[model samples]
Target: MRIALGVEYDGSEYCGWQSQPSGGSVQDALEAALSKIACSDVRVTTAGRTDTGVHASYQVLHFDTQAQRPMNAWVRGVNALLPDSIAALWALQTTDDFHARYCASERCYLYLLLNHPVRPGLYHGKIGWFHQALDVERMRVAAQMLLGEHDFSAFRAAECQAKSPVRNLTRLEITRQGDIIAFELRANGFLHHMVRNIVGCLIYVGKGKYPPEWMRKLLEGRKRSDAAPTFSAAGLYLAGITYDPKWKLPHFVEPPLAALLPRMSRPGQSGCNMKIR
Candidate 1:
């Protein structure tokens, strides 16, 4: 039988999502806990593999198990043995054809950054920080140039294992409240370090290091070194994953991304909404 599970985790302490031989990765901790419940070796497949210091509000995975414990055992029971930073949110029986990675049609990521004169103390590892007054308008203008299908090699990490650099970006939205700036992005797919690199370039534009038009130039150049450095992984979140209705997953309807969104709202706010879809 196959079981689909939704997971949430704070990735600050773990090495990353994939299982590591050293046994410190999030996958290592999860599989150990789940195997105890199944009474057999348990290996799971995830919708996305997040990097160290990245977080996940909604992540999906599937594993095959001959053990016939109730769904609650997979959720509550496995969670009891798992580390406090990781928890299984829900579990459901699904078709064998369903896959956590391939079935996912879209992926959403969020980045929360603190822009102020002083470095962040409270959100040290939970959010990114920059010590300068950023021009949100300029960042918005630069972000728009990233929408639609394009070769994102300019933002690709050198160690990325992806076969292609071309990806369709469906949405890119930036909003701000006080010193907190939020970037919400959705895409059919993302290369390694793509989102963080994009954020870094936007920051460069916002800080007057480059003009908004420089974004289009970088995209066309398709040279990773020509673009801005990759931003910190601390603020990155694997917020949502969408699949077709046939999968019958909860996210088949509306994804639960809204739950992870930053709700920092203020009226007549100069640091406000700038979205491209």
Candidate 2:
């Protein structure tokens, strides 16, 4: 049977999502725990691979297992052997044709930036930080320029192996409350470090280093060198994966991004749970 699962992980300690021979990747740890549960070696495929220090609130993956164990074994049982940083949120049996990566209709990412005169204390690895005050409106304006289909070569990482830089970015929303700024992006697909690189360019515009119109120029340039440096991976989160309802994915949690908004200030911060879809 093919089983699909929703995962939550703190990627701070691992190298990335792909399985590595050294066994440090999130995939390696998950496969290890899963193999123990199945009593055989197991391999899995993910919707997307997050880089090191990048987190995921609802990462999706699918694996074929002949071991006829109950669903809880795949969820709670595997979690028991796994490290504290990784968790299995929900699991459901899926059709053999369903693919965690290819079946995905869209992927969403969330980035948190703490803008203040001093560095972040509690949110060190959880968020990106900048010392200078950023102009949120300017960043918002610059972010709008990134919406829709475009050859995002300017924002893509040099090592990105994706065959095409063209992506249909459906959403790029930026919101701010207090010193914390939230960026929510949804796309048909993403190039490596694409979101972080765009965030870096937005910050440049926010800090008055360039006008909002410069974003269009960068997009037109198609040269990675002309764009701003890639932002930190610490702030990045694989927030959600969207699949067709025909696949019947289980409900994740009470609300989206709940696992990630922990570092928010109280009296509470508004707009932290920005819509992903």
Off by over 4 Å in 2: 251-255, 258-260, 263-277
lDDT for each candidate structure: 0.87, 0.88
For candidate 1, the TM-score is: 0.92
Tens digit per residue, CA lDDT, model 1, 1-277? 9999999898999988998888889899999999999999999999999998899888999999999999999999999999999999999999999999999999999888878767756557777888887999999999999999999999999999999999999999888777678898899999999999999999999999999999999999999999999999988988889998888777633334344334333233344232312
Q: Per-prediction RMSD in angstroms? A: 3.5, 2.4
Q: What is the lDDT of residue 29 in candidate 1?
A: 91
- Lowest-scoring 10 consecutive residues by lDDT in candidate 2? 268-277
Q: Per-prediction TM-score, please?
A: 0.92, 0.94
Off by over 4 Å in 1: 252-277
TM-score of model 2 vs. true structure:
0.94
Model 2 error, position 188 (Å): 0.3
The stretch of ten residues in a row with the least summed lDDT in candidate 1 is 268-277
Compared with the true structure, what per-residue lDDT tens digits does model 2 show for residues 78-188?
Answer: 899999999999889989999999999899898888887778676678889888879989988988898999999999998999999999999998878667788889999
Clash pairs of candidate 2? none
